[model samples]
Target chain A: MSTVERTPSQWRVYRSYHSPFDPCPPRTRYFNVPPNVLQPFQTSARKQFAPHEALRKGTLWPEYFSPYPPEARGGEAE
Target chain B: MKAIWIYEKKLQYPVRVSKCDPRLAKMLIEQYGGADGELSAALRYLNQRYSIPDKVIGLLTDIGTEEFAHLEMIATMVYKLTKDATPEQLRAAGLADHYVNHSHALFYHDAAGNPWTATYIQAKGDPIADLYEDIAAEEKARATYQWIIDNTDDPDIVDSLRFLREREVVHSLRFREAVEILKEYNHTKKVF
Candidate 1:
């Protein structure tokens, strides 16, 4: 005993004439995006690409491979 | 395929090893280069995504990318653990073999100093089979993290390891859901 309601006005029918084997896929109404929590990454990547390209290229991250401070070394025989 | 990538520039869990322990570092290297390690998990899923069904590719892609971040976390722990150890300390701790080859550097090798091999990962192009393998891979990684946690008394290191172990559980759940969705889709299509 189920009732069916019609909502044709809300539906947007899409047509794809290509065969199943076609390399291209039919476009959909929904576009997957980064979640709101991840929106910061999108903004950061945009900024990082601008002034930090050298850092991205590894040439500017000179401290990245620097050795740890001598005082931080703690494996002396007890 | 235009995609937006956001880089949250921080480690998911902080890695603070107060005392540099070369012995512990040697053991942690296994996670970086071990057969069932993060490197293997990342490559397996990333390579498989191209052939994955449209419905599940996103799951594989995101999980695979997260694995790369895990790999970085492990490498960071290893680096900090070996940071300032003397040759004598390293030799006594049984890490000299690795140091002789790489000189306090982080190399892609397991605990036994075996180099990472591409043979560690696989992509069968079948979503169900690959998802099953992914589940097993996550379990293997979680078990390894547990073993690390059990052996170490360092709370700082343990905290990071615990965080990583929890992530494995989450990934397994997501993969399970993806598998169920795939199965339902196939079933519905066959009927219609």
Candidate 2:
């Protein structure tokens, strides 16, 4: 599955409204729903990583990690 | 009898700068000393702990201590990037003012050479207000890391920065949780 399709529920995807009179093309598919919104009180994190992996990711829980690399960001636009 | 931070001999995440790039180092210095920098973050949370609710005091202490580890990581990166760099190289990288003042030594200053100032942080003594500020601070730090990742060519630095940015996300969520915890309390204690 593509990363977009695989994005967890914590990061919700929504459709953007494309207007007819707008000058720029619509970026319809993907925008962020910050993970916190899905969990109001955050009592616990269910899933976790091993010590080595946790150190590498900076979070023991995988759901919270969001990566921003130079390659996939659509250079000069993102 | 009190909370004491046991000395951790290493960074929370490994920090590696592949090659000497004084320019990149100068930019990364912002995280070390800018308004959204780790120093401000560490002090802000730690100072606010005394005034915050007992339920979230441990949360603030844990995140605040971790920020110190991040501060160390940043200092290590800056030192590695500028290691053995010549005065001319430093000047070309727009660190001329820093060089004249610190002479190859790292100083707490932003990418633009603004000295780290106490005005950069606050402790409102209100749990909800303080936690919200903490959340905002995390988002700001995350944005700064993303910008730095965009600007640098070093994969090693990007790797470390990506880790730090994710920690900010987690921290913000924890602060959000802290706010909710505060909200759930009955008003008999006279807390926010």
Candidate 3:
């Protein structure tokens, strides 16, 4: 006992941490425009051409280019 | 700048393809200007657009894209028709030559299976000439589609063909309008 050397002792401290686990709530729905306030907008755009007139002029050719010819009345068997 | 809007002005026609028969599909594809007409129309519009005057560039570009869509529709019809065709049926349809060469590739072949060639398109660099050619091309497409409808027995195919033929008529009108716009532009410049 007399031959042993003594050393100074240091103390260590520990602390416990906790976090809350609250969940997020659902969001409430909102509308920008009132249901009754919205209305379809109509413009006074002039008619460019009548349907038959446009048809008569062949101006719609690009749209009408068919790839099939008319079917024969009784030629389905061949 | 408004080229997209101009192109969007194209009218759409709904076409129904008959899935039950391969022969009808092959025949209907022919109306898409098969081997020559629809491809030619697409190539012509696209090629001619480059030569269009600076003033009419927007119009030309729009028409070119529309032609591209028509080409797609035509190709779709062709593919649907020949998807499961027998060798014998293909032969009877005179498409054996193409099947042997391409093995079901949806090519720009005529009813007889001839391959597409570039001589189908034209671009003279003159707006007037180009417009005239467009009008003629539209008529040819209409006629061909009409012929296809006449030859096919499927009602579904006929309906689609009729729609396409009507589209050609619409395109012819649009080209005529473009020509009118060009004429007006030239007239104003002449006065200036």
Candidate 4:
């Protein structure tokens, strides 16, 4: 569920068009964007992730974290 | 060639395969030698760095070295997935061809079984062009990981793939920054 408001959340969402003519049912709504696109040139920040947490998530900064579709923040909705 | 990067026995990210699925292994092998795979990425950046502007050369070296680490991770994933599976199982998974050639061994080949080659990569010698290619490679790798995650049912494999996918995003950003840095260097040269 995307909106007009511009919050600096890590993810940006988009919907795939559902075509009735297609043979199969459309997939769940919303795709998550990689966080890098939002901040084209990175800025210095004091925020950081703990070492273990960084290793697990693959990024030291929380803002760079981009979750998979299955791990998307909220439950899927039309 | 003397220790450009120190060797670390440990994987940058842990890899554990909870199940043995030769089918998934066959697909995952693409990352090992596919045209857009990490090996091509590593060689491309490493070769391109020798000719790029001094300010951006180290960044290329850094990212290039990390790409080797990523190749290791992909190898680990493919090995764990197929390690215990039998010849029959691999055959059933359309890896019969793979096993015949290199039984229970990993080869640098794509999902379709094409051998790795230098043609997959480019070293344009133009810093901006090379950086742009690096960025494109990163995004393509990210998309490939996402598709693999979509295909597989195993949570463990998906978890590792997600980490690798995120790394691509970070690499892409760094390359983009390198492009900007090169631009600034050109602007400064004109003023001087």
Can you list each candidate's DockQ? Answer: 0.02, 0.52, 0.09, 0.64
> Top DockQ: which candidate number?
4
- Compared with the true structure, model 2 gives a TM-score of 0.83
Model 3: per-residue lDDT, tens digit, B89-176?
Answer: 7777667776788778876666655556777677788889988888778767766775676566777756656656666656666677
Candidate 3: list runs displaced more than 4 Å.
A1-78, B1-15, B29-36, B189-192
Candidate 1 lDDT by residue in tens digits, B1-192 = 334557788875577887667788888988999987889888898888888888888888888888888898898998887778888999988998987889988888888888999888878888899888987888688668867876788878876776676677557666777777787884665434
Q: Model 4: runs farther than 4 Å from truth? A: A1-21, A27-32, A70-78, B1-3, B187-192
Span of 10 residues, lowest total lDDT, candidate 4 chain B: B183-192
Task: Tell me how many clashing residue pairs each candidate has.
Answer: 3, 0, 47, 0
* Candidate 1: clashing pairs of residues: A41-B6, A41-B7, A42-B6
As for candidate 4, its clashing pairs are: none
Ranking by lDDT: 2, 4, 1, 3
- Residue B103 in candidate 2, Cα distance off native in Å: 0.8
Candidate closer to the true structure by lDDT (higher is better), 1 or 2: 2
TM-score of each: 0.67, 0.83, 0.62, 0.86
Q: Worst ten-residue run, lDDT, model 1 chain B? A: B183-192
Output the number of the TM-score-best candidate.
4
What tens-digit string does per-residue lDDT give for candidate 2 at A1-78? 223433443333334566799899855344444565466455564788887888788777766666565233322233
User: Whose lDDT is higher: candidate 2's or candidate 3's?
Assistant: 2
lDDT digits (tens) for residues B1-192 of candidate 2: 168989978777788888678999898999999999999999999999998878888998999999999999999999998878999999899888898999979888899999999999999887888888999999899879878887888888888999888888888888988887677777646537
Each model's lDDT comes to 0.68, 0.81, 0.58, 0.81
TM-score, chain B, each candidate: 0.92, 0.95, 0.81, 0.94
Q: What is candidate 4's lDDT per residue for A15-49, written digit by digit as tens?
A: 46767898988654444457777676788865889
The list of candidate 2 runs beyond 4 A from truth reads A1-33, A37-40, A43-45, A70-78, B187-192
